[model samples]
Target: MATTTLGVKLDDPTRERLKAAAQSIDRTPHWLIKQAIFNYLEKLESGATLLELDGSAARDNEDRGELAEDAGLQCFLDFAESIQPQSVLRAAITSAYRRPEQEVVPMLLEQARLTAPVAEATNKMAAAIAEKLRNQKSAGGRAGIVQGLLQEFSLSSQEGVALMCLAEALLRIPDKGTRDALIRDKISNGNWQPHLGNSPSLFVNAATWGLLLTGKLVATHNEAGLTSSLSRIIGRSGEPMIRKGVDMAMRLMGEQFVTGETIGEALANASRFEAKGFRYSYDMLGEAALTEHDAQKYLASYEQAIHSIGKASHGRGIYEGPGISIKLSALHPRYSRAQYERVMEELYPRLLSLTLLAKQYDIGLNIDAEEADRLELSLDLLERLCFEPQLTGWNGIGFVIQAYQKRCPYVIDYVIDLARRSRHRLMIRLVKGAYWDSEIKRAQVEGLEGYPVYTRKVYTDVSYIACARKLLAAPEVIYPQFATHNAHTLAAIYQIAGQNYYPGQYEFQCLHGMGEPLYEQVVGKVADGKLNRPCRVYAPVGTHETLLAYLVRRLLENGANTSFVNRIADHSISIQELVADPVSQIERMATQEGGFGLPHPRIPLPRDLYGAERANSSGIDMANEHRLGSLSSALLATAHNDWKAAPMLGCPAGA
Candidate 1:
């Protein structure tokens, strides 16, 4: 069997006693400890409790300093194993997969009631904090250009969609001809004239003027007269100029969203914030690998970044220093439940390598959350990584949980149990998810029974708080990382975490640029009029070329009309409405509304998408392992079956 050294920290008295005992037996402490553990495991597997053992054996074990701790450990392990997540979690996931919103919300509501029960005083306290967050604007701090722009051109308008489209696709288009066309299409289609001087943000106003000019140039490119002649000349020359201008604008957006183009640059940029008690988790920009080459390339990037980040961390430790967030998809071409065996064989080693390196520097390595389909796969990998002997004693391994999913609460249960079993404290970052739209669309398109995510935003908020409650309650096993830009969420979590706050009981998180203003108020000494809580920045580091998807998600998240950040930016929104408790809000709706606990009326089920005319084509979930297995079995069963058939020109005699 492969073996590695494991270090156990012991106090002076314990160490002295262990040495003396080893000396008495004329055996090495390592061998003695190994034998004790092996014997304990054997007894545990045999289902024998310490109480069940003979008095003499129990006394001998006590003399060797093993019975008490081992018994407790064995009991906990047996309990954890008995309720093993594989069955419980799988059943929970399957049940929630396409459950009706009315059915799912109430179930979650009950869990929330038990987990994050509403308190009148905590609500008021959270409201007060949120009011301060809204009124207390920073003085000449780093301005959030994207926030301002998003406010000026809200996603409900044509201009906002145009901006997002251009930002998502412009720079990535290589050929100038296609790039120019995309720029012209997006710029000309938007109504920029109305926004000429309406926005207070300089960036927004400037963008409007530039967009208006380009719109005019493109709109009048073939008109007749002196104006037309000037337009022709400018349009001929302006297409390339317009393309360059759009590229620069996208890069500017990238700058606002992304920390830097490289790991070193990102680290250096993080210093200023680090000085202000703002830690960071740098995520390298890239998508899921489509090929082995892409996977290796991403792996190399992670390794290089880890080395750089580790050296910069200087062993400040996981909680106090900077860390890195890694995507499982980036590490493997197929990180899904359907490819379970292949993933276990192929991807597990790469994940372990990155984690071990991160452990070498004692910095946190968080597994970034992806789509809902991969949730189980990620948990499987996380469970394996936690029990890894090489990674023993390392508390820097973390996992991000998206509270938007229906299965979030159960997933938390599984993770907490996993942490206890592995004897490692896991950092759990709870965030209101980023893939709401995609998850909704996917479920509807697949003709799934129900959406995997909440259709209404308030339900997601309630889920986040519920999950937060669960995470905060388990401080022994979990170090909760609350990531949100909503002042209401921050305040609720702050109050829920308790009034007496320490440096790291729990911490808040925000995006690199969007969160600074709000977090600046929360992070620092309480005597200095701050919340005195630590806040980490989720900073993405990459060049403009790789910033497409991340930027789009950020824009969509912040620009939505229902977003607290968006509403906070618009002073017209009252503080009371912005700070309304999600739990109470849902309850109030339930009391008054006809269709209280239901999904959004506009988002119909897949079968009812056309109202009555047609049903959406059903698609098998390729990510589901059991379904895939059944499909494979059925295909194989019919693979060799001989079939003799012919199309008859006329009806059979019976017909």
Candidate 2:
């Protein structure tokens, strides 16, 4: 019989399935098909002849056994036999590959039966290990403790996996002696180098221990009044990094004042650079007054600060340069509108006198924004001050507009119209509003129709850019001081201004510590004649304690983004890395340090511990692991304490 060889043909659906299966196993479909063919051929090939002799002629006989036993030869022969005309061989092959449910179900059941005992044995081993660890812990033995604990616990599969991972880390400690040596070395050397190569778990634990130890030491020193002594020593002479950190922490925490002495030093510094065209804005700490008296005190403090700056300017032969920012709420509250009007009536006249004096000295006053309720009052005051017959000088007054407000465009238009009508030049300092969360909460509490502050930041940013362009369009409006830290937004402002041909008509402003890179970049451009606008740094001056609110705001802003935090933590290997390393600096701050710990490293208070203990005393189950971890009971206790102590403080405002 004459036989013909045929190629395999697969249907589109079957071919797609085959390709997917091959992909799943990371094999080429051609390779898979060839392998399958070889497998099938091997199963069918019995004995086969490789050659034929001429009819009726005596042939040289070759041994069939040698070739018959060859697996490759048998496969080829089987494959040739399987391919027949009109056989639908491809479909047959696919069908053969598919398992019948009847067959599969029984096989699956049998496999489960086989695996059950193995799983049981594994669990038993784990239980034994965990039990041993528990016993050892009771007997106070450290060796094999982690392994034993893992074995005894009836953990879920995931937990079991984690236990194994943790055990690997624990075993890398070498021995108790080595571990102790490492700890002792780190403590004595005052530098803890993590051995993450050994195990990630060990690295994490070691880092946590280091932070805890540092925190504990700081707390103990603070409690023992050693911090004050350290401060004194540092004040006299200390390592530059230590001095700078401590000084910054102290100044930021508001525990010390921006003293008359500090102000004098600032003036001296400014005086040295004024001849080179440097200017200064002197700000006194204290704002958010609850009463007229409080407002008056803050006002008086500003007056005093201005007077000192004036005196210093007179002596240095440098006129007061246009720079000063003031918060409106510091003048009076909205609830006391009538009283505040009277307070303002008196305060405005005095402020006008200061402005007149400042005008004579060439100092500029910028009215800063506060809560939304105070925005109207701030703008009103600004309009009056700017229009006042005595203070209409080109750069005599400036007002801040928070671009986050939905109505900022209207505010900008109003200012432009006012400038046009009054024929007085105006300066606008634009900021993205700072009190976003507070404003939203107030709106919620007051049942306001909508949040006047733009809730979405993208919208606010767009508004800011629009307002910036609008302000830049008005040549009569002084070059606005654009205060922001957002690089993209800043770049956009610059782009829009350039596109509109207002290249040299805007100045950028940023906070003191933040935006250093951006500030330097912009300033460098100005210095190199790439740009002609000025760049200003808004340096905040106050004791660290008084600046807690500001610090909190900074933390909240950074912490709002989880990705930012994770990126920071990944880069920051230690506290020093977090504080000193530029990449990890931004996200190291805790968002809510209120009850978790002290606001600053130098000021260690027992707030969290005390709250937890109080919770325990008040019938809260502090011993509950979940409660301890979550800090729920501690929070309740703190709230209760605040409620109880509020009355003793004598009034709601005082509390």
Report every candidate's CA lDDT.
Answer: 0.81, 0.47
- Stretches of candidate 1 off by over 4 Å are 1-85, 113-120, 136-144, 224-228, 625-645, 648-655
Candidate 2: segments with Cα more than 4 A from true spot: 1-210, 213-261, 268-279, 291-293, 310-322, 333-344, 499-504, 525-532, 562-655
**Candidate 2 at residue 77, lDDT?**
40
Over 235-334, each residue of candidate 1 has an lDDT whose tens digit, in order, gives 6788888888878777776788889899999998888999988999999999899999999999999999999999998879999999999999998887
Highest lDDT among the candidates is held by which one?
Answer: 1
lDDT string for model 2 (136-243, tens) is: 322122212221222222132232223222222222454544433333233333322332232234423443354344433433432555668775653343333332
Tell me how far the alpha carbon of residue 168 in candidate 1 is from the true structure, in angstroms, after superposition. Answer: 1.0
Per-residue error (Å), model 2, residue 25: 87
